[model samples]
Target: MIVTSYGKPAVVILSVEESERLKELDRRVLRLDEMDDAQLHEMIAAEIPPELRYRIEDIPETP
Candidate 1:
C-alpha cells in the first residue's frame, strides 16, 4: 500500500505477488532521472531475453 504526503489522500492496495514484483524491479532498475540516454538504452537492451549490445553515446553538456 502507498500513502501520499500531498494531493488527494488515497489508499493503495496491492496483492502480495504484485508488491513483490514491484520491489524486484525497483531493486534492479536505475531511476530514469539518474541515467543519461545511453545508459537508459543499455538497461533496456540488457533486460531483453536474447541479449542486445549497444554502444554508449556521450551526452553533450548543457551550456
Candidate 2:
C-alpha cells in the first residue's frame, strides 16, 4: 500500500507486485517530519515482511 499525508491524508493499496517494488524504498534514514504515521505505516508495512503491523506514536522531535 502507498499512503501519503498532506493534510487530508492519502492511502493507496498496492498489489503484491507493487508491494514488492515498494519494499525497495529506503526509510530507516529519513527525517520524521518527512512522513506522518499513516505514510510511515504503509511504507514500513511494505518494506518489512511483518506478520502483524503496529502503530507507534510518541516519537521524539527532530531538532
**Model 1 per-residue lDDT at 57:** 65
Top candidate by lDDT: 1
Residue range 1-63, candidate 2, lDDT tens digits: 446797554988778887776676653457868888998897777754465545566455665
Worst 10 residues of 2 by lDDT: 47-56
Per-residue lDDT of 31 in model 1: 76
The TM-score of predicted model 2 comes to 0.23
Q: Assess the local accuracy of residue 29 in candidate 1 as a C-alpha lDDT between 0 and 100.
A: 76
Q: Over the full model, what C-alpha lDDT does candidate 1 score relative to the true structure?
A: 0.76
Give me the displacement of residue 45 in model 1, in angstroms: 6.7
Error of 1 at 58 (Å): 35
lDDT of 1 by residue, 1-63 (tens): 566667754878899999899999889876789899999888778753444634456455555
Off by over 4 Å in 2: 1-9, 25-63
Question: What are the lDDT figures for the candidates, one per model?
Answer: 0.76, 0.69
